[model samples]
Target: MDPENAASPPAGITREDLFERVWTTPINHLAEKLGMNHYQFARICEALNVPRPPAGYWQKKAVGKEAPRPELPAALPGDHARWSKGTRLLAPLPKRVYRRVERKAADRPQRPARHPMLIGVDESFRKTRTDEKNEFLRPYKYLLPDIVASADHLSTALDIANEIYNALDLKGHRVMFAPADQEMRRRHVDEQEVPRKDRKYGRYQTGSIWSPRRPTVTYVGSIPVGLVLTEMTERVTMRYLDGSYVREDSKLVRSARPWQLTHSWTTEQDLPCGRFRFVAYCPLANIEWSASWQETDAAGLKSLVPSIVARLHGSEAELQALIDAEEKAAAKRRKEWAEAQERYRRQEDRRAVEQALSHSKKQLAEIMEQWAAATAVERFFVEAEKRLEHLGEDRREHIQSRLALARAMLGEQDPLSYLADWLAPDERYQTRYPDH
Candidate 1:
């Protein structure tokens, strides 16, 4: 087997055999061969009950100044005494060395102390740092459609945004895409302690005309979290200055401007691309925002993610408080609105009552006038009947007929009954306008 890619530890290498491997080569070189850093290799040696070659052991061997090999220490119960992932075994290995490694499985694998996301982000960032375009774990198209990046120049911005989203999603906050002017009743507490909503149609529009597409935004619940992506580039310019073919006429040469159209490179640059920055908006929490610049490397960028997530989590309490305040304000406004409706209804009822009262009074006056005129006519007819009785039966009969006609014309219909109905207030109206 090639020593560089040894298959595995041979079956039966013991502590003494492992020490021999270290003593044969400088500890640093041996560590490189094992693909482990010198410090890590040293720790592994301490764990494995193997004594590393002492300082200068390699130095003496290099100069042909020999020293006796140090005795290998006995394996203690806590000491790891196996050639495992970090060591190579000699060809003539004991069959039992493999058994030792198998028995020491507990010491072979050590889980990293940091989160996996942090590790992956660092690695990914490093690989793509020099890339002109952004890199994503998966194709950009697969992400939620509502996230429309500013332009192709900021294409990779979504990747960083996704990094933030994933962190929050893992923490149980559901991410939602918010359309422009969404209908959701978002309440804000005003100075008057009233809850007011600024809801509008969410469909995109320009100049009062509907637009099919609009800028994308993120939301958690009704609160909008704005995502802004900006790109900066460096630019350069060149200019040429020529004054070649001039005869050395001393007086003319002195007046000639030699610097005109000089050939040279003129370069101007804006902010460096290496310092890409992003911000996370927390609208619910006093419109709070947190921003981070991409770190110098993947590891730095990875380190930045946690703090951004922390800031977001830290604002949860404030967000809840703001929501509560808004709810209370809204409730108050609703109560006020209901009261105003009741007032308007009462005013309408009172107006109705006043109108009916005026109408009934007018109707009652007409009825009284008709009743008076009928009474006067009946009295006159009775008198005529008594006087005419002495004259003749024909005259008396005519008078009596006239009197009967008059009585029939004035039927028993009471104007007062009609007047009463017109005067009586409606119950529905009175309930709202009791005084009327």
Candidate 2:
């Protein structure tokens, strides 16, 4: 909220009157007169081509170092020079949508103690870094502990992180990087007091998500707790004009009026309150556990590390219970998997045995069919020999000679050979599940 633009009028002040009032009185007081908020009044001034005083104007004026006020320019051909009392502004965001609790104030610690891990990490962080939000510096190095803070607040945030790390160290809770051999996972911890909709839920943030090559965790007894330190961001109201939302003090890229471009919007950046938040979580997969502590205006985070550590120590029993449950669940799953494998094996073996039996029966049936056919051939030869006894002597001799030729022409069939070639069920398939 701009302090120069204050309580508006019931009849809606004219462009000339609005411009004079904006420079003369604070917007907060003027807005209250019209029963309007500071944001609505500020937008009204922009819509009417009335420029409000920049931030720190009132503060400077009090000290007699105020800058010169610019003359209100005549409206462009399409610009609005007058506003009605019930002037329509863009719809506001719901109260529930962006309601963030204000974080407590933080006071810096002088010559704050440094952790062993962060001793040389400062130089490394500076070696590889990127700009964030035109204000914050994000270091890409993951060897450093996960700490998210603007360049201005980096020293303070690091001091808080360092003190906490060493305090845990002294208590025998060793704050260190996760071992390479361990297949641990780190969860993204958001410290900004931004709404869910405004936040960018990306994997790569200012060391908030997958920034750590290895998770930074501390052992509270047998339970491992993943830790992250972040400088919390306060919700700042930004005006949207010329296709971007920026601070009131920032220059516009393009001269876009409220009617020409879109309306104002809010941002999740800090008008930077130096609040810090510390988060601890379970890094193990499928285990849902986390705890957080935020600095208050009354007490700084550096002074509370000992108490926070004690709370973390107290949380051990709860974490242990979750671990025990996970172990028991894993054992049950293993047992079930083994039983399923064994059951499938038995089913396959029984199927093989049944197939073998069926195959042997088919072979026996085929052999019996061949044996019956062979018997008929033998019967025919035996009957023909008996008939030879009734023929005349010469006829019998000729017939018997012809019959011998016919018998030789038709190959002799052996009935016993069919039975000898047939196999039993055991020869067809060997069964593993003999009981079945």
Candidate 3:
């Protein structure tokens, strides 16, 4: 069948006929017969210019009252009375449902770490700056490049990273650089694909939605936990739609004003570096640990280490409990369903037995009625037997044959004996059926 014809209104039903049906039946009930939702059916009626009864129509009819249905307005010149077949109901697009994440309670105070990742790093600055591009740092090559940080920021970042690494390392975890492979990249909570040119930016390109990163991979045993980073200087961005640029010095600013005026432009100047923080996350466990981005300096980053460790263990326990509860509920539902099926089987068996007993009684009554009728005819022939001597031979033979047939119908014994058990009925009923 063509899809258009399937969805179109039934053929031969005019606009007036549709109006009568809508006013007579509830819209929801009518819509169901048409294989449509109430809203969709209403839209179809609107398109056809069909009028409907107002909301209280059914309630008024229930009380032996009438509700006035609206008069259908005239359709425009191109309007059609018959609905054209369109696509059947399309499923609604999926929506993301946000759920509140459960966090572990912060009840116990934790002890400070004894060994951090950066504990043995050399502190001396080199006369000529060199990139930290070795095999150990290879995974981070495209992401966190070895751009030289200011002497102070570098010291703070290193110290923060050391404390966070040690906190995990002491608990049988490892903090290493992220692997460059796609499989490892997918494990990061903030990982996403971007255009090729955006790959070198460490973050997704401007105008795209992505958070900043100072990439390092954390591991619990052999399992990779995604990007853990130490926060450095704060940068705020102002985005706009423009094809213009800005330069710094007074003369450069004056020169750029004309271009800015010609084309609306925006600027995103970095703010002064503030106290550093550290962020630790385990994407597999859906856990994130970080002190306030603005509040944590080198010392504060070390303090949060204990809390982060405690929460990781706590989250694992909670997740297990949730799984156990769901399994128990599923088992309970299965047990209840089995019990309901058993009850239905017993009820059906009882109904079959009751129906058989009722039918047996009806059969027995019909047999008894047939026997009584045959007995009445036999008595009539008994009286007429003496009078038959004076009759002709042919007439007497005809009367005798009918009397024999009446005797045969009554059978040799009491009617009840012949019908003692009707648990199973006879193979076939008599030619002349009993009324009941």
- The prediction achieving the highest TM-score against the true structure is 2
Worst ten-residue run, lDDT, model 1?
A: 202-211
To one decimal, what is the Cα RMSD in angstroms of model 3 from the true structure? 30.9
Ranking by TM-score: 2, 1, 3
TM-score of each: 0.39, 0.53, 0.28
Local error of candidate 2 at 138, Å? 6.3
Residues 336-425, candidate 2, lDDT per residue (tens digit)?
999999999999988888888888889888988898888887898899899999989999999889878987887778878788888788
The lDDT for every candidate, in the order shown, is 0.46, 0.71, 0.48
**What TM-score does candidate 3 get on C-alpha atoms?**
0.28
Q: Candidate 2: minimum summed lDDT over ten consecutive residues — where?
A: 90-99
lDDT of 3 at 49: 69
Candidate 2, residue 7: the lDDT equals 39
Candidate 1 regions off by >4 Å? Answer: 1-145, 150-154, 170-172, 177-310, 349-360, 398-423, 426-429, 432-436
Candidate 1 global Cα RMSD: 26.6
Task: State the lDDT of candidate 3 residue by residue for 75-169, as single tens digits.
Answer: 53223456534522212212323456566568854533323333323243222233321101112223331222334355555555556566666
**Candidate 2 global lDDT:** 0.71
Cα error, residue 54 of model 2, in Å, equals 68
**Global lDDT of model 3:** 0.48
